[model samples]
Target: MKNDRRPAGHVVAIASGGLDSTTLAYWLKADGAAQLTLLGVDYGQRHSVELSYLEATAKTLDATYIRLDLSGAAALLAGSALTDARVPVPPGHYTDVSMRATVVANRNPLLLDLAVAHAVSTGADAVAFGAHAGDHTIYPDCRPVFVEAYRRMITVANEGFIAAGFQVLAPFIAMTKAEIVRLGTLLDVPFANTWSCYQGGRRHCGRCGTCTERKEAFALAKVFDPTGYETDGG
Candidate 1:
């Protein structure tokens, strides 16, 4: 059993309380890689409910979870569905390009930038995210290209004091949400503790794009979704 204490020099995971990130945390932990510091960004998104789950997930994994709220900055993006109630969260399976607006622009850059800083300051060797291929078409920042760029930047940017610089890892960059869910199951991640609804409802709206994808992922993985949700008979 892994202890909760932050390791002297460990790997840091970017945990958004979404399936992918939570799964990453569990996978790394299962591998007995090292102690992990779970990083969650509260960017003024409507689905703040997910933050609660982030806390629970971290606690369950015996990992340290820290929050960096960028809500004040994210609040400026009024048209994004994650921030604006009027945007009307889109429903059903949508491609990444079609779902682009939902992305908080510069979100990945800012989050990873801070994560890098955290890694350097704390002597962590790497920073990881839950970005998958499905996100690439819509969220360029989630793509491998961007990840590699950041990795290079982090290395060249911090070449002196910390010779053991940081690296950005995205293990699922080519997998789909369903594939991620499947992998998560293998890692023994507590799926119920992860939240993916874009709507800030008590239960998942089940109609939003995120909920739909999440439902489909579990379905594809041939696993039952244990989360609470209000679904319409479709």
Candidate 2:
């Protein structure tokens, strides 16, 4: 029996350089799991710095990396704290209501469509993303239902253009951040190389919603975090 059940083919992954996406990159490339491409979309988020991490991960994994500048879209989606300087990045857990300030309108669908386009052009069999269970409550786009509907929509829209047996994978869909952290640890992923701050500080702000979630994920996973934080999170 084959040890890994993952299909063998070219795959394009939507990479954000955060822990979840970084770990997904590692998982996708390890042991020659697939022909991997890391696609980063910068929609003028406060932390464009995260793309730098993705660049480094691509180098380490020898995976092709492409960054699309979608900053123009941010002008219209500027109400989100990620895209607008006027809005403050909420500090707290992801489940907090205020964290909705981080949601960029139509963010996932736009990104996913771009990935699907690239996959069709390149004949890649899959387009994968990192949308863990913890994100389900925070972002409707990250929910399993959205993923399923997206797959169906693309299958119908692309019809015969996409690769045979094309797939949309969200491998961590059922997992919480802590669960992903554990899997990353087992995969020997260098967690420190990943970024999770909504702020583009030299180090993690340690108070933003994503930073708080990152801190909690490591603690819950019993993994030693190597990230530097500007504050003690007090």
Candidate 3:
């Protein structure tokens, strides 16, 4: 199938050091992104360990890695479980109602804004993010409508610059986490080096929504997960 919207040339990827984003980075490179830059945001989330994995993934991919410190944003967007210590990170499946606490208000937009600015400054043709179908239920920003609307907004916001070929890409927007896992496997992504738990512990807290999702994705993909969790969610 010919993709009319195929991405090419310089690309900036918003990476969170998780399975989806890490996979997205590798996929972009394999799909012929001439130059790739991985952008990680430090918004004072509990799982700062993900930043470490972000750097490692960039090294593995031989892409430039940049970290933007948005810790101040955490204070402003404080009610979410990820940034607020008072609100606990919930356990169990991602579909659970309690998992909504993990949503950081306007996170995708804020991150995408930063990424787009970086892309514009650096002469990038596209900006990519790893948001997937699994995130739609919990994160409003991860849905297809939001992505398309944001793309249109960016296009209009850029005006004449749109002719320069600035595109907002979310390749996995319609894909499930398991599908991403399968694709990542095909791309030989180093899943062991990735991090996804909401808790910033030494090891993954398998009970957390992300960790559980990760485990489930690998299982569903029939891939052997190398992640070492503090406890077995199974």
Candidate 4:
């Protein structure tokens, strides 16, 4: 009898070089259970710093890093801060509806489609993302409901050709950014290697929505945050 249940397949991880995604990559590595392929999508966001950061992270983790260019999609969706040259990336919490300017239309869905394609082509059994609770508040696609729905979509979307099947694993969906930071620290994730500033500046703006939340997470976690921020208190 062939051992079909072996855990020896590639696992594609959607890495954006942010706190959550980077932490997810490290968590998978800590488990030491399967091959990992890191996917970093370039959707023409002002911040390319995170892409470079992910390359460094992949090097450190010794995982294969794939940079997929979806800048065309960003060009098409120009109203959001992430793609538009006019709107500024709102400097507030993820819950602030105004901050929705950063969300590209169906952005997560697009990236997940590419990731799922790669998984099917490579015979991987799973695809992972870093959609934590904070994102669920703002991004419609990052919520648990979307994740589950997408899981079923992909499964049916990639039927018998991919005999093994796939699952959308979100290990941090229920946790706040603070709790994620705390847990990631415990996993020895190199937070310093990650970048969260959406301003595309030389250093973290420290005032943007992502920066504020990142600061708040570390503050709440009581961990020494290595992010380059000018402010001292949240």
Candidate 1 deviant stretches above 4 angstroms: 1-9, 163-165, 232-234
Q: Candidate 2: deviation at residue 47, Å?
A: 0.2
Model 3 scores a TM of 0.95
TM-score of 1: 0.90
Q: What digit string (tens of lDDT, one per residue) describes model 2 on residues 1-234?
A: 021234688889999999999999988887355689999999989899999999999999989999999888879897899999999999877655787898888888999999999999998988888988887777899998898899899999999898777888888888989999999999899999999999888899998888999999999999999999988663
Query: What residue runs in model 3 are displaced by over 4 Å at the alpha carbon?
Result: 1-4, 232-234
Indicate which candidate wins on lDDT.
Answer: 2
By descending lDDT, how would the candidates be arranged?
2, 3, 4, 1
Clash pairs detected, candidate 2 = none
lDDT by residue (tens digit), candidate 3, 1-234: 112154578888899999999999999989998899999999989998899999998998899999998887788888899999999998898664787789889989999999998887777888989988888877899988898789889988877664375678899988999999999999999899999999899999888888888999999999999999989653
TM-score of each: 0.90, 0.94, 0.95, 0.92
Alpha-carbon deviation at 69 in model 1, angstroms:
2.6
Q: How accurate is candidate 2 locally (lDDT)?
A: 0.88
Candidate 4 residues lying further than 4 Å off, grouped into runs, are 1-8, 230-234
* TM-score computed on alpha carbons, candidate 2: 0.94
Question: lDDT of each model, Cα atoms only?
Answer: 0.79, 0.88, 0.88, 0.82
lDDT of 4 by residue, 69-170 (tens): 877766788898877889988876666677677777887888888888998888887788888887876689988889878878987878885646456777
User: How large an RMSD does model 2 have?
Assistant: 2.7
**What does the lDDT read for residue 12 in candidate 3?**
88
Inter-residue clash pairs, candidate 1: none
